[model samples]
Target: MKAVMIREFGDPRGLAVVDLPVPVPAPGEALITTEAVGVAGADVLIRSGALAAYGFREGHIPGGEIAGTVTAVGDGVDPAWVGQRVWAFTGTGGGYAEQAVAPIGEVLSLPAGLSAVDAVTLGSSGVVAHFGLAHAHFSPGETVLVRGAAGSIGIMAVQLAISGGASAVAVTTSSTERGRRLRSLGATHVLDRSGAGGPDDPTGYDVIIDVVAGPDMPAFLDRLNPNGRLVAVGAVGGQPPADFGTRLMAAFQKSMSFATFSAATVTAAAQQAVRTEQFAAVDRGELHTVVHEVLPLEQAVVAHQKMDGGEVFGRIVLLNSPFH
Candidate 1:
């Protein structure tokens, strides 16, 4: 099996393709013949060493999610899973290879019409978005905002917000073309990445799915409707400072709540259900996955470079072979 390894941190060029023995599944796990691997922002952060505090060591593989077919299952697993097409979380590492191992619980079968590429892109991101919104306590006809709205998670958040009956969906992004693309994705208003935020209307917003949090987050706090909640799901912009709460104190009167969501903590059954719902929605034409491009697995370095360049509109995935 071939995998991309990070020989060093701080540079995408440090990612190198290397060969290794294929891994066998342990108890309660399955071995997947890699078909598509998701290249995500967190994977880039892992490669850059920014997330070193997360317990991962050097020389670790960088992919987090993969979609493929089960070739074998370990003890206590159902043999029927063998030959079933599925999408899985490869835990803290191991998804960048031609073959990867995952716990059976993390693997979900793909529906008839969902291709591996679409499944990996939608399955990985959709589950995260669904979990965030589920816990954020959003309601019908309310206003919502999604930061970094042109990215994979952002796109899903926007469409899901609309479908959930939000009266309006606002987005934040740096590119004009990408903002236009986001609008087409159902964002009612698109705000510049650095701006006063969508006017201080009292209607405000009931929920916010923020993936990009930084110094300007306090501004969004004022944009939230009273009793509204802001769910911090990603820090692509940068992590909030240690005095984050002090900066946003002015919004305390609104009884606003700031919560951080990590899909890792969600139950496997819940995550699998979300993935299945998203695939079904895509099949029914009620949802869509924006794929920026499909690159070969060996081009992981180039993919990281593009992610850092900051113009990508949606998910950029890697594949081990050409498949339908």
Candidate 2:
């Protein structure tokens, strides 16, 4: 099998394609013949060795979400899963290959009429957005502000907020054109990435789904209304200052809250359920999957480079079959 691995870390150039023996499904796992895989911001972090403290090793295969057909199933798994088109979570790695293995519990049957590209694009990111909102205790009539709302998860958060009946869906994007694009996805207000204007200015938001947490994060705490909940789902912008907690203390009177969320923290069943629901929504035309571009599996390095360049507005998918 041909797989992309981080031959070294810190540069997109470190991602190299090499031949490897195909991985076999362990008990309760399924081996999928890859059709497509999603490249995410976390892949960039892993490639750069930023997640080493979390057990990510050098030379690791770096992909999380994949869409493919199951070719085989392990012990205790139902034979029915074999030969089914599905989307799956490959956990931290093993997805950047022609074949990948995932726990049976992590595999989801693709909704009818959903393409592999769209399946991988929305599979994991949609689950994160759904769980992030649930963590923040978002209410239907409340206002929502998706910080750095241009990535895959951020895009999903915007639409989920609207569908959940948010009185207003606000987003902080990098430019007017990107903001306009988000508006087309049902964003009611598009603010600059500076986190100003709209619900963040005077009125404040009832819930804020932030994907970018950096030095600017402390400032967004002030944008939360009383009793507001700010759930940090990703920190592509790097960590906030150690003293950032002081911001929450300063807002003590307002009872504002702040916490970080990861889909890993949620139960597998819960995550799978959300993925199923979101995929069905997409199949039904009630949700959307925004794919920035599609590249072949061999061009994994290019995909990582584009993600590092910061111009990617949505998910970038890699097809196992080369493009002619």
Which candidate has the highest TM-score of all? 2
TM-score of each: 0.95, 0.97
Best by lDDT: 2
> Clash number for every model?
0, 0
Whole-model Cα lDDT of every candidate shown, in order:
0.86, 0.91
Model 2, residue pairs in steric clash: none
Any runs in candidate 2 off by more than 4 Å, and if so which? 198-202
Whole-model lDDT, model 2 = 0.91
